[model samples]
Target: MIKNKISRGVLLGILSISVDGIAGLAIFPVLLYYQPKELAGLWILLTSFSALLNLAQAGLGPVITRMATEIKIDSTDSDIEKYYLKVNYCYRIVVFLVFCICALLYLFYIRDVLIKSNYLSSGIIVWAIMTLGYCLKIYATKNINTVNGYGELGWDKLIQIVVTVFSNIAYVIGLYFGLSLIFLATIFFIFSLVYLYGSKVILRIFVKMPKILSRKKINFSEVLDIFKQSLKVLILNLVSVIVLNVDILIVERFWGLNVIPLYSALVKIVTLIIAVSLLIQQMIYPYISLSWNTGVYKKARDLYLKGLMISLITSIVLSALLFLTAPILIPIWIGYGNYLGAKVFGPLLLFGIVYTHFHSHVSPILATGKKTYITPAITNGILSIILGLLGAKYFGINGIALGNIIASLIPTIYVVISTLRFFKTHSKYGGLANGEYKR
Candidate 1:
């Protein structure tokens, strides 16, 4: 069973990567063809904002993965339905709240800034449409995560590939039609709805009997337990969001919109590599919860190490490829304006990617529950931001990349090592509840 799951996970993960890669490569070309250079930056900015907004729902998926794994392991079908509805209720509430928050922010503040900066031609319309779509996407995201927790990584990735391929096709159509950002945003929203339903059909058919996270019972205590763990995992996510994305935001604001297209093209491609790096951990994430629950720490640890080794080696090879071709690739792919800076941006960002990718594997192990990983993550995230801001202030785009790389290594070699070691130590002793955890 383990071998089957792992094999299926790899197969589906590769398919997901290929389709997503095609989509990622396809979008930039279409965007470049349709929009001006500055607007490309706006595209990058809005996408990054969408990613940031996703942080609002950060803890929801992992919590689902953890809870669903527990219920599945115990063969507790009764608990499953109740847990599903209860958490689904909370998820809907979260979606609404995030929707309102983004709506209000755009209404009062960001809309004007975008117009003043001339990034958004439709201003509030674009903001409103995209914000709502992002929220829906955020909401739909849990379905994929929930299925993942059931130890169905292959099925989860299949669902993910479907949504991704369809959405990017929708995006490409919008570009070909010469739609404004507003129309594209509308297309995004429509696709979100499609996948929202599409995920249901996939989960129902593909998942084994008794889907747990879609429950009717509102188990408040259990719900709160999930929430608390999610909250901590959310913090750990900060480390990731910052390291992968913060540079684009920094460049967008400080260096002005024009420079962003240059920097962001490289960032976008590299972000794909980072996403590939993350696939290893994400594929095994549910197993961390499952094996931990089953008291199969040795199995979990061994699988995790194997995944980590694969990701690390993959990232290193990809980084070398980026160095050779990114300079040449950027101008060819996006067309050159001020994008010459990519020559410097690629190598430094790849340096950060290595550590960041290594840490991605480490994080899922620590983040299966609770806030154990939060402080160090929060500390490193903050430090990265500080250095990023200071670097952007003094050194421009290159410095910001440098800031993230430097701060990324700090936690990779030092802070997180001790945590993993301790966790391993305790796992051998008995189980988590019986283990002594020092804050």
Candidate 2:
């Protein structure tokens, strides 16, 4: 039965990932063929800037996942209901807070910057709509946690597949019709609707929170505990954005917006690696959390090692394929005789992604509720920014990519070694959790 469930989860994960890749391939041509160079650069910057709103979620989704897994493992009907309510409440509050912050950013900084650049001819309206899109995206993340906690990867991935397909179809149709950025941004609102629907599906099939129990008052203390755990996650999130997504803004600041299209293309394409490599870890995340929380540490370790090995193999093969075909495939996909930055950009960005995911084993560690264990990741990311800047100062774009790759190596090795050692000592000492363990 367990193996059957795992196999089903893996199948669903692959389905969802194929949807993402197809969406990527579908949209790239639309973006390149339909949009001008300047507008395309602004679009990239807008998407990158949107990542900031993600930092504001306060790590609620991850904590909810952890809590949800614990609830599922403890296996009581009432327990699931209680967790669902708490997660719903937290998701609402955090998303509301993030939307407020985005409103202020638009009024004070973003609107004027875009205006000065004279980018996005549709003007502030498109920017406003895009900002709303970011908010919607963040709100939608709650569905992922809710389903994951229930150990329903099939439902989870199925929902993602629908959402990705709809959003990509929307983007392609909008761009082909020469619609404005506002219309494109409207796609996010559509995805949010899909997510809300998915949440309802999860509730009906998995959570089944009773109407009588639903009347219970919100627990502020429980919310506070989640917030405290998520504070570290928030900082780590912000640092990651600073490290990974801030480059286009920096390039725009120093060099100008003209070069942004090429850089954005490189980054987006390289991320295809992560999109595929993470499927196994993400599919098994809730199980790992449940197993570890229930003191089945050996099973958790096995799952983690297995996921990491598979991830490594997936990444290497993709990287090799990237090197082999990028030169030929990229030109055909994005058009010819444009974007001089593509040549060396592809390989370096591939290496950067490899280093970033090098410590895939860390996922299980994070699941164990050691939120502070992310300090090394956060630290490495910040240092990567510094190194990337220095490299940009000396060797330009390729240099920055190399710096990011270099910065990640030490942290990856450190996390792998520390995590293994910690696992050994933990098993030997037989430390207790929630008063559950073996001799």
Candidate 3:
């Protein structure tokens, strides 16, 4: 029965990820062909920038997942209900905070871009709508995390599949008709609301919270405690963004917006490849978390190793395919002008491979509730930024890509060695030491 459930979860995860990957690829072409290249570059820049807004959540989703998993493993139904209510209350506060922050950010920064583009009226309205939409999606994340904690992995992916397909279809159709960027933004906002409400309905199917129970007041102390636990995760998240997604901002500052279309194409392809490769680790993470929380340390170690091996194989194969075909396929996909030549592409490919290799292992360590990965992540981000600036100043794009390769190499080695040692210590010690093993 356990194996069957895992098999089903794997199938669902693959299906959802496949659709998401295809949607992402499909949107890339539409973006390039339909919009002006500079505008296309700006759109990509904005999309990446929006990801930074996730910082406002302070990495609460994973903390919720871990906490809920523990409760599910060791507590009663009433306990589960209490925890869910607390999480739900905390998320509402986050939702409001996110909306206000996004609004202030747009008033100060994004508004200037829209004004420069001469789309001030439409753009401001679009930004406002999108901000609210984004907040709604943030609020909805609790529902998904709650579902994941209960070990309903397949159902969790099912909700995402529905949301991704709906939103992507809206985007493609709007873009195909030559709709203004504002219209597309408006549709994005609309679908976010759909996702928010739709997920609540889907979550009820697996686990329902009674209306009376949900109305009970939540303790502020619980909210404060969850926030405190998420502090390390928030740091990890902020630096991860700097390491992985801030390249375009750096490129714009040094090389100018004109080059971003070319640089972002390379980054996009690599980002997509990395996302697909990480599916194995993502699929197994919940199980690893449960295993460690239940004191099944050996099973957790074995699972981490198995997941890492599979992820490594997937990444290498995909990277090799990309390396071989990119010179030909990229030109055909986004036009010859956008292709970043082999010299620049090679280092980024190596960077992706090395980063993926370590991340695949380190994520499992995090699942064990170890903070060992945080310091390495901080080091990686700092070195990558420093090197990235120096490289962009000297060697152009190739230099920046090379900087990333160097930045990641040390952290990669440290993480892998540390991961092995972590498991070995657990094997000898028999259970997690200290407060790391929450019960």
- For candidate 2, write residues 279-393 as lDDT tens digits: 7887777777776777766677777788888888887787778777777877776767544445456646566455546547667777777534466777777878888788778
Candidate 3: residue pairs that collide: none
lDDT of 2: 0.71
Higher-lDDT candidate among 1 and 3?
A: 3
lDDT of 1: 0.70
RMSD of each: 4.1, 3.2, 3.1
Per-residue lDDT of candidate 1, residues 95-124 (tens digit): 886787797767775776688677555766
Using lDDT as the measure, what is the rank order of every candidate, best first?
3, 2, 1
Q: Tens digits of per-residue lDDT for model 3 on 148-231? A: 776776776776688789888888888889887777777777777877786787678776455456577778897899898888
Cand. 3 TM to true fold: 0.92
Stretches of model 3 off by over 4 angstroms after superposition = 431-439
In model 2, which regions exceed 4 Å deviation? 75-78, 107-109, 119-121, 339-343, 356-359, 428-439
Q: Could you tell me which 10 consecutive residues in candidate 1 have the lowest summed lDDT?
A: 430-439
* Superposed Cα RMSD, model 1: 4.1
Worst 10 residues of 2 by lDDT: 430-439
Q: Give residue 429's error in model 1 in angstroms.
A: 3.7
In model 2, state the lDDT of residue 403: 74
lDDT to native, each model: 0.70, 0.71, 0.78
